[model samples]
Each structure stands twice: as structure tokens, then as C-alpha cells.
Target: MADFSSEIRQGIQHISESVFMRLCEKVGTSQRVAMRRETVDIKEMVEQQLAPNDGTIQMLSGSDREGFRLKGSDVDHMYWPNDHRVIMDMSQSEYYNMANTTLILSDSSESPPGFTLLQLLTPTTDIDVLLTCFRINDRVFISSSIFRQLTYLASLPNSDIHGPCVSGDVAGLEYDDTLCFVCDYWPPSASSWIDRCQSWPDPEVVDDIVRNGCHFVAVGHPLGPHANEEWRLSFSQAEYKCVYAMNHSQFLTYGLLKLFLKEVINHNLGKNNTLLCSYHIKTIVLWTIQQNTLPHWCPQNILVGFWVCFKLLLKWVREGICPNFFIPQNNLFLTKVNGSAQNRLFLQLHELYKKGLACLLQSSSVRSYIIDVLCSPRLYICTDESIIKCEVDSDVELFSEILQNDKTLAQVFYSCMKYLYKVQQLIGSHLTQNQVVMLQRLTASILKNSSFILHNMYTYTGVNKQMYIADKISCHMLKSAAKFGCVSDMFYIAMYYYRTLRYREALSVIEMSKVKLAQPYLMYREHVDRDRYTEAVGGQSWSTKMRKAVVLDIILDNAICYINELIPEQQAALHNKQHMLVIPVFLMFHFLEFLCYRHIDTTLSQAALDELQVLVHYDQGLFVRDIFRDISWEILGICQQITGNLQAALYSYQQSLEQYPLNLIQTATHTRIQDVVSYSQNSN
Candidate 1:
């Protein structure tokens, strides 16, 4: 019987290895994690640069910061005004500039573990702060409920409160922004966590974590006596650092636990039920890792690591005591994870444990990976090297998508230029090395777009001294942008030349751009040659590879770069949410080629026109993103109109209208259709 049991364990371990091999491909590898860290840092820097210097610090948090790009995950943001500072005791008040800071003393004597009552130490003229404070026995304390209520009131228009965060959907992405106050000292309640980290996290990491201190979010323990008055201690900064320090396999295991919780457990319990959350999963992983519960956290042992965390969670649920990682005295499962919910959750977890590794098959997100492992046990081999290559390619694609979604042409143009001086100041003093690189990229984009706007503004029917000076400045800016920008950015130079009727120079630039675009590692839109990427950038550092390797689509802002001939079409595109005409690089490239050739060579112009039509009609989302399809079709219709193909132009306009209305150019398309009808009538 012992022999049979040993055989069973061996079989499970073998299956576990295969399962993890597949998970590496699905959940992402080390490269993806590193890229995600850089992406998060860059975004944080950009937000800091753009935000008004209102004595507040903003941080991107949650899974997005943790490096997981899971679908349906909310973007978490934490904001704390520098004016408000929470100290552990009155003695710590010496550290603050009392005149500029609203000192708040943390009183945990009457509160539960991991919770504190903030006592205002000094008088404040701030209305918002005053509104949230009340006197309790002649000592003024900030009320958690009032603080949360004010945050909700001041949140985005459609936002609602979700614990400490104001939750809302913006442009289809869910965002959770938490308003909190900073505490410069690590909470005494969690001081034991530092000692506990002696075995796992390096001593330096522990010291750094302690030095960063903690935050007090506008939330209280539901079961605590002073729930309304108490604020919950948050270790989000320390938590981020801990996650950053995790091994790739360990990170993937955490991701797997989250996936299981979301796809399997949550699906079974339904959305209305809230017994377990991603935080619970995180806490489980953190404790398991810190305690060295698993002997190995390699890819081969990822499932084993996950199983250990899963069993621990089950034990916690059975006992109705989910301890906070930092302060074990604080039972996280005190409220909702008790009573009927506790019993239900335990039974569910127990049943899953009985099924063993088979339980993972229930997770829709990872089910196929398990099946793939089971079916091709012999073929399923995932090495660190292979996983890194796969993940780097995937990271390139994801980063490209993020760049497209996050930075709109108009936003980049206006925001960077508007805050140029502030951005420069922050770059020198505040930003990290990675953030500075990202800022350079942003600077390039700003310079490129600014040149276009200047060129358009100074454009004249006849060349003069003013035109000459503007042209020189615009040309210089475009050349400067190309140095920091992607290969596609060079097309802007071609665009400037074409717009100024320098056909030969434009064609020369276009030819150069075409050669660079043809490079195997030049990723544009959704197009990426993985094998080529591996060959070209597999060994380079994430930042270096991204700088020299990844290519972004060239965006033409309607307000800035559109030709005068397409004023009507440009005006129509401005009705979209971004309030700018956005054109994809390939579409713009072909359009420019057609225009330049129309001035110099008719045959080449017709060929360029034909190519543009083919790309607009037959694009498989490799050239244009789906969100901009309407505009792409409109461009085609406009080109057809320019060529006097009235019937084809009308058909193209109708096609444009048939696509997503998000482009908000339907009115423009309708106008073009009517114009085509009018022209046909006039010809008859």
C-alpha cells in the first residue's frame, strides 16, 4: 500500500510539472514580469509628471502593478495627500514640518489589530479634512466613514465605493482609486512581520520595507468596536516590493491561485458572494512563501507550490480565521468569511481537495493548459530559456497594445507640452532610471506632434521668411523625435515633406521607412514575428530591447497632422471620445505615398491608391486596431472621392458607417454619401 501511495504521488508530481510547463506559456514567464514592472513604473512616472503639484502622491497598485494582465482585472490607484501625515505617536511630530503638514496621531489602543484611530494633532483650515473630523471626548479624530463618504463624493461621475477604493469604469476598463493618508512609521502591529521575514526575504529587503513605512486607508474592521472611527493600516508599498522580489515561478504560482479563485471558486459562488478575494489569495501566497512552506518554487514545482497554498487556504477557511500576513492577530475572515459562508466555502474547498490536481481543470482560464499537459506529456517541456523567449515576444505585443491604449496622439501632444517644464524637473530629480527612458519616448512623441501642429499653423500658399523659419524649426523637431522614437516615427518626417509638397524628399523618407518597417523585429500594431524577436532581442535587457526593438504605429492627429484637403473628414473624426482624428501608421503611410505620387507620378499614385483600398477593405487587424476601423474606412472613401470614383466613394462611406460608431464619423460619412449623390445628379 505504501508503494502504491508513493507511485500515486510520483504520478501527480509528473503531471504537475507538465501542467506548470503549460502555465508558464499562458501566465507569462520572467520576461513578461520584468516588462510589466517597467510598464507600471513608466505609467506611475507619467501620472506623477502630469498631476498638479497639489501635495499629493499617486501610486498604481493591485494586480496591474503586480505584473498580471489578466482580463477583467481592475486598475488600482492609491492617492495620499502629502499635507496629511499619520505618525505612530506624538514624539514623531518632530519629524514633520508642522506648518505645512496636518499631523495625525495613530491611536490603536481602542481599535482592532491592523486598525487605528487617527487623532488630529493640529488645527487645519482645509475644509475637506475638517469635514471628516469630529470631537470624541474633546479629542478630534478623523471618522473613517466620513472620509470614505467624502472620497466617494469627490470621485469620478459614475464611481461607487468599494471598500477603500472608488470603483468605476472608464473607457471600458474598470478602475479602483483609493484615497488614503501616509504614515511614515511602520505600524507596531505589523512589526513582528519583519522578524518573521528573517528566513525568507533577505535582510536588506526587510529593512527597505520597514523604512518605506505604511499607509492608512479609509476603511475599518467590520467587527471592531470603533469601526466608523478607525482606519485600516495598508502595507501596499511593502507588498509591491515583496511581489517585485518574487521568483518568476513563484509569481506564476500566485497568478495561478488568482486564476483559480476568479475562474473556478468565484464562478461557483457567483458574483454576489464575496467570501474570498484576490487579496486573500495574495495573503496566502505571501505567508506560504515567507514561511518557506514549499522546498522549491521552480516551474516544475509550481503546481506543488500552488497546492500547498490551496491547502493552507482550506485550513484557514475551516478555522474561520484568515490572518493578515503582516499582523497575524488580525483575522481577515472575521466578517463575510464566517457563519454560513465559512461552512459553504470549507465544504467547497474540501471537495476540491478530494479531487486533488483534477480540481484545477475547473478553472476556465487554465483548464486548457492542464489538458494540453495531459494530452502531450512527452511533448510538453518548458525550460526557463524557452519560456523567456516566448514571454519576451508576448511582452512586446502587450507593451505595444498598452502604448496604443494609454497614449492618445492628442493627449500626448498636449499633456507633454503643457507640463514640459514640470516634466523636465521631475525627470532630473524624481523619476527612476527606467522612468527617464519612458519620458524620453514621450518627449519624442511630443516633439513629433508639436512639429506637425506648428507646420500646419505656419503653412502658406507662397514660401516667405516666416514659412522658412517655421519649416526649419519643424524639420529640426521631426529629426530630433526620430532619434528617441521607433522606426515608424520616421514616417512623420516623410509626412512633413509630403505636406509641404516636397515629393522627392517625401518619397526618399518613405523608402527609408519601408526598409526599417520590413525588419523582422519591427513590431507594429498586432504584428510581431516571434522567431525574429527571439533572434534579435532575446538576450538584451528588457529596457534596451524595448528601446531598440519594439516599433509603435505612427499616429496622425486630425487637429495637427491632417492635410487641408481632408478638412471635412478630419472634422468628423473629432466627434470621437478622444476628440481627435487618429489614423494608423500603415494607413497614413499608404495615403501619403498616394498623395506624394499624385504630385509627381500618376502611375505610382494609382498603385498607392489601390494598395490603400486593399489595406482598408481586407485588413485582418494587423494594420489598424478595431477601435479605429471606422476612420480607416473613411480614409478609403475620401481617397476614392479625391479620385472622382463617386459610386465607389459612396459605397465606401456606407461601409465606414457600418463599422463601429465609436469613431463618431457617421455624420461625415453620411455627408460624403449625400455629396456623391449630388455629384451623380449634376453629372446626369
Candidate 2:
């Protein structure tokens, strides 16, 4: 067990160092950097282009600005008129006067004391842009009339009537881009909400966040569906500050936990459709940090730290409620994860933990193998040049019979768990060596045949009851098999010993089985790339063969989905059409690897800016092109200031101010630059 602990520590270090480094190298590449830059550029261009006629365009919220942005993610922008009084002065009747008639009106409504919501389509982004009228004074608005009108607007016809906003495509938008709906408050201010947090957080951090100001994001959608036009006061800036305040190891722990959720829990056995999400994991991490002392986060105790995080998740699963970090009354998991699913997930995690780290502590080469398989390029970019030769015709009849009968993968996992439980219960109750050997082979047989049961369960309706009985029958057969001398049974016997804490016996059995048992194989196979896929099939029209292939793929996904739904923590959405075809679903699975690998590098490089100067130079685009273009130079300057390189920091700050000069950000950047310059002068 102590040896197992050492192996686990080595694995943790490999994850934190080697895997983290690989992620940084991948994320800090020209292609990823360019994608981020292009996203920001598109937002900026759209903002600038829309400014003159519409109003002042501001980038309200983005993961990029907050510093958790990954590649290919979109940016959020807001539109507010230069004159605050323009919309503020409009009466409910006069709301129609302000509308641009050329812009197609999806919905329009009025509120007392003068408020109007005009949902319109913009030319460039082709997403819905929401314009609302309201007065923002020193205090936040809590008007019932306006709230009523906001809620009433839900009845109006629009692409995103279900939620606060819509994405992908709905109606009237000819483009295929995912739409980010925007909402504007005339007297837009989050100061009132910011002031309410004075006694809650570290005062200095709150003060800094207040100085940065906050955005009142519209939350009138039916999802959370609170009061109409209910704007949630966001403290994202403050949240980012809190994240950055952590020591590097602490940050690495946070990143690893996120990776665990995405890769191990989600990608494993096609469980990506589970109710657990990155945001939920992030909130748990934040809560853990807030309650615990700094010593709990020591680098050597990272495994323990990870366990702590997992325990928090387990606690949430059992309780069936995860409180919102800032607002205690708000339940993050309220409608998301049902109680049955929670119990299933709770059991799943319990099994994993009980199995211990030997199962988890794979060699670095193995980790690389897993990462490479997960992050392969085939999952993302479609490089088929066959589009020129092929034609896509939308035949409603062709897709009409496309079956959505498959279940989530979580089902198979649940079945496996039941069998394992039975094995555990029967293993060490005064059993003889022969009995133990029989138990081992039985468990292995159950593991092997569980796949068939899962397939039958997924394909047919109402098969769960039959499968449950079948599972018990399989367990009974194992008891009978105990009389035989099966060499393959030793591996199972050892696993049971390991699980039950008979470590020496477990090791001895493993040693005895070494000559008899073949090496266990893991096939982390690659998804076919678009080029290869196109070449294999050749360019062809949408035919019955293609449709049948699509149906088969859908069936495979349905099996995974059925398995996942057994737990039901994930959002309930049909697997996207791409996922149901011969063509691989949007690019490759490398995203799972990169989730863990990519984040730690950003954290470490930012923390150790001095040592990173050369890498930063090589990946200059990481600084210049991405969402951090404005802040990149500013961060560089801060690093310089800390390292006593005052002249360098001064130059860096100058570049920061030159790129995107927001008053508060520039003021701070300028202050640092000036202080550095003054210190250099004094030294001279």
C-alpha cells in the first residue's frame, strides 16, 4: 500500500509536470493562439463596426478576459449607447421609434415607467441582439412592472424563447455560427450588488473588484426562469482575481480536478453526457479553498487535495444540492441532477476510490498514450476536400426515420458496478483458496459478459428488470465455478485481495499469476480523420447507404447515452447529428487530454514569468494575438516590476495602454509603469 502511495505520487507529479507541460505547448501554439485572436478580433471588429449606428460596443464578459478561456471558444459582447439618457428617456409607447426598421424584429414588448425589449438580428454575427431600456442610478433596479414585461416577452416568437439566449441556429439567421445573445441595461451598473459583498470576501479583493465595476447580465430566460428580465449581478472579475491569488500548486489542483471531471468521468466509457459540468467543479474548488487553510494545499499532498475535491463532489451527490458559491440560496444543482442519478454517480465514485491509486497511477508513457488518443486532431478539424465533389441535399424524409433509440453509456457502468459489488460481498467471508480462485474467475466473467447485457439493454426497451435478474444469476454461477482450477482466476483473486486490504496476499497472487496471465491490453484507438474518411468512402451523394451508416452510428451513441442517463447528472440533449454518423463527431477526442494538460502551463508560466521569458518570446502570439492582447503586456510589466526590471515593465505597460485602453485597466497599468520608471530613476 505504501508502495502504491509512492506510485500514485509519481503519477501525480507526471500529471502536474509532464502532462501540464504538454498542454501548455499545445495551447500556446500558433494555431490555437490564432483561433483565440481571431475570435477576439471578430468580436472587436463587430463591436467597432456596430458602434457608430447602434451604440457604444463593449465586451461585457468572456472567459478569455477572465483568463480561463480555451481554444475555439466564443467571446461575449454588449451594446450600450454613448448617451445614457437616449434609451432612458424613451416612454413605453416611444420604444418603437428607437427601433431600426430594417432590422428584422423577432419580438417586441413594453413595460410601465418606460422599458422596451426589441429582439433583433444583426448583420455580422447573425445572432440575436437584445436592446432594453432602463434607468441605472446609484442603486440596482428592482421594478415589478419591468420584470412583468420582461417575462411577457417570453410569449413572443424568437429563436431563443426557451432560455435567456439561443445558440447554433433557430430561425431568420442564415449563418451556422453559434449565436451569443446580448442584453443591455440603460443605467447599467452592478455597483449595488458589488457593495453587498463587502463583509463576505477578503475586503481588498472586493475593493479591487468594485473598482473594476461589474456587469448586470440578463437572466430572464425560462431555464432558471426567475423574475422577468432578472439580471444577475456578475462578479466574474472578482472570481478571476480569487483564482489568480492561489499558489501555483493550488491552481494546479483546480486544473486537475477539472480534467478529472472532463476526461476520467466524462470521456471514460462514453460518459460525457453526465450532469456534472466544469462550472460545478470550479465552484466546489472555490468553496474548498475558502474554508480550508493554506497548508492543506501543499504540493506533496496533491493527491489528498484531489481526494478532498472528489469528496466534496460526493457530498454534493449525496445531498443532491450544490449551493451557489456567492449566493447560498441559489442551488446550482436544483433542476440539473435528479436524485436517482445522483445515487448512481455516488456509487460509481465510491467504487473508483475504493479501487485505490494503483489502478490510476499509469506510467508517463501510458499517460501520453491516453492523452494522445484523447486529444487526437481528428475530433476537431474536418479537412475533407471532397466538399467540391460532393453535394449535400436536405431530404426531410431521409432523416425522418433516423432512430434516436440508443441509451447513454452510464447504464453499462451501473451494471458493471452491481456485479463488482456482489464479488466484494462474497470474496472474504471465510472462503477457502479454491473458493477465492472461483470468485476471481466469476467476477472476470461477469466483467466480460456485462457488455452483452448492456448492448441488449440499450437496444431493447424495458430490459433493465431482466438485466438486473441476469446480473444476480451470473453472481450465483461464480460460486459454482469456485471448484475448478483456473489460472486466469488468479488475476481476479489478486484484485479482490487488493480491494479488501489483503495487500501481501494480493501481491503474492499477482506474482503467482505472472507466468500464466497475459499482459492486459488497452486499445486507445484513434478516430478516423476527415481526409482518411473521405478517401475510404470517396466523394458521394447522400444515399440510403450513408443514411443506414448514420443510423448505426446513432445506435452506438444511444448505447453510450443510455448508459449515461442511468446516472443523469449530465444535460439531457440528443447527441449532435455529427456524432451519429460514419464521420467522426467534430474533430477528435484530444480535447479531453488538453483540458488537464493545457491549463497548468498557463498558471505556471504566469506565476513564473521570469523563467518563462524565452518561451513567451517563442510563443509571442500567445501574448499578442489571443484574448490577452491588451493584458499580456500588462502582465509582462507586472512580472518585470516584481523581478526589479523596472525599465522592461515600463515598456510592457506602455504596450498595454497602446493596445486596448479601458480607463480603469489603463490607470492601473500606467500607475505600475510610472512607479517602475520612478524607482529606476531613483536607483540611477
Candidate 3:
């Protein structure tokens, strides 16, 4: 529903306001009217597209500040902030001539002797992206330069000799070049500058960094003259989204991140980079910068923490200095965004594996990596049992391509799995309403690609093992989920306990859960019939599975009990008051029936759907569309299949898929679906 996507705007002159107003409302309703207007003044547009503090740059004309450039930040702003220009005057020309070709130097340390330089544009536009400079009369000792690629520019000094300044080397930066500076995160040496910076940015740079930016739709021959487009930048600002004023020094690191993140950016000029480059050019300048210099990046924790990303990337682009940044190779970024999840952190982590199969079309590289990491089939998880039949045949057809030999592929899939687990956890109410909304919108916008999910097949594997760490993540998410009124986590917790055969505990959780449902009652009944034990058993595998299920059941039971306390039952008119004291006396126990229900499917298999069905049938008051959409249909279909009704399962799956229509769906996919389509078509 976008007014014009980079895909849509490829060949349109003007998009009718009426046609795409809905899209404008969703992404940038406030700026659409002002954005659609055509104007010949490219300078005005360029200035507008600059960062929030762009005005501060002009104001600091009188100040001695130098070596600073601007950069564009997030996608909230249109792709190009200062990309359109009609070539008018000297100052204006410098802004628009930054297209065509630009050189990319990965790390400065890779280059020896002097500095590394790459040609930016084919010819030249009015814009200058880099401000190169060195010391005054000391060519033997260089200071720093700034890259023009952020909302505002860093006013690095040309004469500030790095002296004995040491830059740190990152170990695994090659991972996410998507945002690599020196590499990993902050190395040890680069983190000492938290106290070194005296100046931040000029005042003008502060004024222009804004929230809503100008949008332009222009095209011509690629890199050809007369390719007209509108551009916008400066407007308003905020703490998380705006530019700072007096405390400019606080944001130099922000400027640094914009540069090295491997993102094509847009912005206006901030300080003078080429100022002293022509006069003073000599010594090696070591740039020290990183994202957050707190804790690990703390000047104390890591001896070479300054090379961390976000900040290090900024330093690399601005000051033309790059050193290895340490990226953690041991990241199991699946459950928690902070590296791991709490409640089933290890459970999710264990799933942090992959079976080299992308719809039977495997990526050899990914397979190789998985084999090496998983140590045979033992390390991987296979959701599709049917695929086992085709494994030998697939290898025969694909030859060695099916072999998991590529290390990079394994790493990538591992990363994907990690992301999926995190995303799964994120689906709970723990995220902010805005974050939830954003995630849903994003999900809707991007079709749920099974392949994509397979790509992040293992985002995190084993981030950390500390029980406290997992609890911390769970605690944070559970709280947020509570606040936003989204208790996906609570539901899962309750289910987990029931699965482990903790009957009493599971009942307590369901009764206390904020969400009122008869499923808890049903689970309690099931648990009472099975999985209950007085003491520990000695079967190892049986015990482990039972233990995991028990924990989950206990958690669920606690949630159920909590609900009773939350909504003190309507004053019992006929009940004895003395028995009310007994009502408060609750036993802490777990249920195994719910655990069996919960563990039925990691992909939310038919069991969970059946539980939801019971809730819908017995508890209309607890039914909510958002909680678990299409569960009734899913259960009905699956139940029919159990009764040898294949047609019903297919129909039910189709209904479920359509019931929760996402934001974005490929038209191609609409005509054909996996679980439902083939069966339905064959039957027809």
C-alpha cells in the first residue's frame, strides 16, 4: 500500500495523491502534501534533506571547528535525502554531484604508509562526501578527516595529532558488513576516548536533524543529466530521533556509526575536511571510536574496546581510520535481542540448528556449514519428517551440492536460526506497542518467506548458559508483555509446565493467568489423569523431557492461580466467610497434561490448536481473535484428518492461512500453498 516503492516509482511521472494516500498515512502522512510538490530550487531541497543539525553547520562557520560531514540515518526518511539537484551554483553543485561511483575502503589498516583514497563520483556533483585533512605544519603526524554520510557531521580537528594513539583490531567484523566498522564490536584499545572528546558538533548541525523528511520521485538515465527528483532533509528532531544542541560532544559517536554501517546515505556537509588536507598531510592518524563505550566497550572491561561497531564504523568513514573491531563469534542471538532468551532460552538455543534443505533445493555452502557445526544430523533440527525420504535422492540429483561443506553457508543459516528464535520470542507482548506494531507491519509488508525463515535458520545457537541471564531476559519480556496486554509468553509458560506433567502447578498458572480460558481447566484434567509423580524417576531421556515439561506446566499453573488473586471472585453470597480464608491457601504444583499439549508442536502444531478449540467451545468470554487467530479452524481440520478426513484438514489449513492474512503476500503464493493446496487440488 505504499504510494511509490523503489519498485513502483521506477517508471512513473506522478503518483496520484488519491491513489496512494493510504500508504502516505502509514509511513509519512504528515509530509506527503509538502513532499509531492515540485520545485526547481534543488539547494532548498538539499538543505532540507540534510540532518537535524544541518543549520548548526552554517552557524559554526565562525567557529574553529573543522573536519565534519553529514549522513542520513534510518529508513523512516525517504531513501535519498539530498540526492536531487538541478545544478545551479557553486555551493549547490557540491551537494548534488556525489553519485555515479564511490570508492569503498574496508579498513584503513589494510592500507600501508599514507592513507587510503577512492574516487567517489564519475565526474562530480555539487556535493562533497569526505573532508580530508592533516596536522598544521606537521605532515609527519596526521590528525583526522570526516566522511559526509550522516544526519550531522563530526567536527574532527585537522591538527589533533593522534600521537601514540593505538587502534584495536576486531576479530570477526566480516560477519555483518551490514554494519561493520573495524569488525566485531568495540575492541579494547579504541574504547578509551569516552573522555578524550572536548567538542561535539557545530550548532547548525543540531537544528536540522529531523523526524519527518522530504521525499522526492525523480528518474532519468542512470547517472544521466536531467534526472529530476525532489529531495528533503531538515524538519524536526527528538532525543531518540533528533539532533542535539549544546551537548554536541555527546553525539560524535553517532556520526561515526552512520559512516561504517555499509549503508548508502544522504546528508548535507557539516565541517571542513579538505580544509588543511592540501596544506598539512603526513603522519598516520589512528581514529578511536565505538558505539557504546559502556560495560564491555567500557574503557576498563576491554583493553581494546574502542573498535566496536556502530561507533567504529562512524570513525572509519569520518576520520579515515579503520582497525579491526571484535565481533563475538560465539553469538547465539536467537531468543533475546540482548543475545539470548530467558524462559526456554536453552530450549530455543538447542533448536538453533539447521537441516540443509531449502524446499529440497539446497545451498551447498549452507549445508557444509551446518554439517561442521552440528556434527552430523545430531546437531540439526528437521521439522518436515517427509523430507527424510528424499535425502538420498536429493543428494543423488544435486550430487555433492547437497553436502554441508561450506563454512560460510553454515554460519549464515546459524545466523538465520538465531533470528527466528528471537523473532519467535519477540512475537509476545513483551515488545512495546510501537515495536509490536512495527514488527507486525514489517511482517505484513514482507511475505513470510519460508526460505527467509530457513535463512535465519539459526540466528543464535548458545549465547549464554547463566540461569540468571535467561531469567533476566524472560523477566524483561514478560513485564513488557504484561504492559502491552500481550501474554504470548505467559501462554507458552503455562503450556510448558503442563507438558512436564506438573498438574497442580499448571492449574495454578492457568487460574492466575491474566487471560481467562478453559484450556487451563482442560489441561488440569488431563494432567490429573497422567504425568503426575510423587518423586523423581531415574530414566534419563524420559526424565529430561519430563523435567522440561514439568517446569513449563508449573509456570502455566502459577499464571492461572495469579488470575484468581487478580480478580477476587464475585463476593460469594451463599458461601461461608470462614472458608474464604481457605480460598487463599493455595498449593504450588505443576501439570503434565498441558506440557503434552504444549510440546505437541514447535511450529504450533495441532495440539495447541485443539486446546484453543476447547477454550472457544467452553469459554466464549475468553475468546480473542488476536491471541490465536484461526485456531478453531486449524483444530477442526486437523481433527478431521485424524479421522481420515484429508479434505477437511486441507480446507481448515486454507482457512487458517487466509484467516491471518499478513500485511504482505505474494500473489504467486496465493494460487498455491503447501499444507492445503496440493491435497485440495489433487482431490479436485
All candidates: CA RMSD (Å): 6.4, 32.3, 29.7
Compared with the true structure, what per-residue lDDT tens digits does model 2 show for residues 1-684?
Answer: 144586555555444343333333332222232333333333343234424433444543434433333433334334333222122223422433334422322121222111223322222221123223333333223332343334434322332322222222222221111112222221223334344553335777766655554333344323432346444434444566666555545655666666566556665444235778766887887777776733445544545566677778888877888866655555677666767877777887777677554323332312563355245523332222222122211111122211111112123545456556755665556644323423343343444334434434544566777755754554344333322323333333443333334456555554554443222220011212334334433343333223112211111222233222111111111222122111111110111111222233444334345433443334444212332334445545655665567777777778767763211245566566667778888898
Error of 2 at 677 (Å): 67
Lowest lDDT block of 10, candidate 2: 583-592
Model 2 error, position 640 (Å): 54
Question: What stretches of model 2 exceed 4 Å from their correct place?
Answer: 1-23, 26-54, 60-62, 68-163, 169-203, 220-229, 268-273, 293-302, 356-366, 369-684
Which structure is stronger by TM-score: 2 or 3?
2
TM agreement with the true structure for every prediction: 0.73, 0.36, 0.25
lDDT of 3 by residue, 549-663 (tens): 2211111111122222211211221121111111100111111232333334333334444454454345433232332233334434544454445665666556645643211
Error in Å for residue 280 of model 2: 1.0
Clashes of each: 0, 32, 144
The count of backbone overlaps in candidate 2 is: 32
Q: Worst 10-residue stretch by lDDT in candidate 3?
A: 173-182
Q: How well does candidate 3 match the true structure in TM-score terms?
A: 0.25
Error of 2 at 236 (Å): 3.2
lDDT of each: 0.77, 0.41, 0.25
